[model samples]
Target: MTTPAQRQTALLVSVVGAVIVALDGTILLMAQPVMQRDLGASVAHIQWTSTGYLVAVAALLVIAGRLGDQYGHARLLFVGVLGFGAASAGIALAPSVGWVIVLRVVQGGFAAFLQPATLALLRLAYPADRLGKPIAIRTGAIAVAAGSGPLLGGVLVAHLGWRAVFWVNVPLAFVIAVLALTVRTPATQRGNSPRLNVTSAGLLAIALATLVHALADVPARGWTAAPTLLEFLAVIGVATMLTRHERRTTHPVVPPAVARSVPVTASMALLLVTTAGLFGALFRATFHLQDVLRLDPLDSGLRVLPLTVLMVLGSPAAVAAMRRYGARRTAIAGTVLVVVGIAGLSRLGPASTWMAMAAAFAAIGAGFATVMVTATGTVVGDAPPGYAGVVSGLKQTAMNIGPTFGIAVAAGATGTAASTMGSTLLILAALAALGLLPASRLPRRPARQEGEHDTTAALPAQAPTPQAAPARHTNS
Candidate 1:
């Protein structure tokens, strides 16, 4: 049995691991220019530092999650954190940009291991009904880390150096490892230990990597560019082959149960569109702020502080709303807010006031927080415990893909100029409005409350058995 203290420690570890990863993603954006000049790297070379990491993480997430399920989440978490820190340290002392890019990809590999385990750790510690509040807390912490990254990065980069930003993750990782050591995570993987289907895993990885590569190129190369078209065709072909293989494979990277769960599948879709809208708008706004408005990086970050603030506050509020109005209703409400916010963004101009920008940011942040918390809760709570790692991985994979999709579309619209910001944001707003389709698919209410017997096939507290049929809800 998980003690209350152990539960709390697990939460801490999850939050810390999550924050470092999210913070690292945002913080590095601020440091890139400095790194470029210092390392004498070309724009293309510096772009790979981020692209390589993104491709590596996106490609390997499902496989990493499967590994965590077969092994133990705690063991994977420990190794992932250690390796991530080591890679960060290596980047800090790297002799050239090449080393930095290589180490970054290594760091991304470790991060793929770390992320799903964070959620799996939570699923292990908390009962289904009690998951929302902790997830809300985790969501809030992630918002804070992500929101403050640019400001923090600016401070570190200005006062200390670009390398200081990376150096910070080492101590944080050490702290996570120490706290994780005290948590008693029982071996939670259930069912027969089937052989991993390496062929399917490889295909999925290639598909995801190719998809990201194809999308990332949209901004630089037109959609009709030969290289872009070829990459996309490759993605489609590999995805088709992976689908066929998975249908036949007994041990798919994404568990069969998870693939079949409507709530899980819908939640993943919802997360993807939601993030795509959020990040696409943010990506465009960042350019409009710095390049068009001629604001410094710090000032640009501050103007959008309202978004962060709302995300922090809205997470808990969203959970409360979920309990009162149900996931479906709450998600619809949240999606509406995002649509309105993005529409508001479309009205921004070179002469727009900070107050106008802040209002739009706040609305988008609040809406996103609500949907994210609700969808994440549904994804975790609706699924059986045995498949938590893969589910978490699937959830994370949607998140990774969404931002790239959003950015690619937005980049295609705006190109290198801020003159088309208005039209580009309008396109994003339309895409966000489409999220209503998935939002409507969430459960009208949670199937059961906190103290009630869970209907899902959960491992017994004393003796986990393979015979338990994890209950699934299509439209509860």
Candidate 2:
């Protein structure tokens, strides 16, 4: 059994790990232009740094999660945090842009290991019924990290230079490693030995990589472009192969049990569709604020501050609402708010006041936070402990793809920013409205029996802790 102290420590490590990763992602956006100039790299090369990281993380998440399930979440978290820090240090001291690209991808691989472990750690620490509050706190922490990223990046890049942005992660990683060591994760319950299907892993990786690449290419290369079409075809073909292969394999990448959970599947689908519409709307609004309203980047960021503020506030509130109302009602309410926010955004014109804009942004942020807390809690809470890592991996995968997919679709809408902005917002809002289908399918309340651990059907009731071994440290 996990003691309260250990649970608190787990929460701290989860928040810190999540913050650094989210911070790095957003802060890098600010430092990119500077890094390009400092490294004397072409625009495409600079863009690849971010793209490479995204692809690496997206492709390897499920595999990493499986490792966590097979080993221990705590063990995987330590290695992941340490490697992520080491990769950051390499990027900080890189002699060329090429090195930066390679290290970023390596860092992303570690990040994939880290992300799923965060949720899995929580799964081991907290019982299913008590998960919502912790998830709310985590959601709020992410909002804070994302909200502060640009400002923090601006400050770090302005004074310490672009390298300092990366250098900052080293200490944060160290702290997380220390905390990880202290937190005791419940031993994972597995049979004799779980065999990983290497061929299935490779196929899934290729399919996700191609899908992300195709979407990423959409802004620069139209849908009909040869490379884009070919990548999409590759994704379809590889996915087909993976499905057939998975059926025949005794040890599948995604277990059949996970695939059959209606609540879990619906939650993942809701997250993907909701984020696509929400983020797609945000992408278009960013351009409109700058191009049409002629607000400087700082001013535009300030106008959107309400969204961050509301998210931070709304997450905890969502937990209370969920307890009182239920996940389905809460999620549906949140979706309506998003639709209202989008409708409000569609009405904005050149003469719109900053308050009007901020109100709309706030609605979107608050609504999204509620959906996030509810959906994520549902996914993690409903998952069997044995499969926590992979379920978290699937959740993260949907999240990673959603924003990219949204931005690409938004970019594809025809006409100038001014002419197409309202129509695009409306289109996104309509798509978000469709999210109700999945939201309706969510559990009305916590589904697990009180005091019962959500364990897999085949897993043993009691797990044996592995023999104490020296912590394996990786050299940077």
The prediction achieving the highest lDDT against the true structure is 1
What is the C-alpha lDDT profile of model 1 across 362-402, one tens digit per residue? Answer: 99999999889988888987666667777888899998999
Q: Cα RMSD to native, each candidate?
A: 2.6, 5.3
Which digits, one per residue and each the tens of the lDDT, describe model 2 over residues 1-476? 68999889989988898899999988987799999999999998998898899898999898888888888788889999999999999999999999999999999999999999998888878776778778889999999999888888888999999999999999999999998899886665554336668999999989987898788778778778898888998899999999999999988888776777777888888888889898888888988988998887678778889999999999988888887778888889888888889889999999988889889989999999988998888888767677788889999999998888888778876533688999988988887888899999887653343454433334322222232111110000
Residue 369 of model 1 has an lDDT of: 95
- In candidate 2, how many Å is residue 299 off? 1.3
**lDDT per model vs. reference:** 0.84, 0.83
lDDT of 2: 0.83
Q: For candidate 1, what is the total of clashing residue pairs?
A: 2
Give TM per candidate. 0.95, 0.93
Kindly report which residue stretches of model 1 are placed more than 4 angstroms away from their true locations once superposed.
189-191, 446-448, 455-476
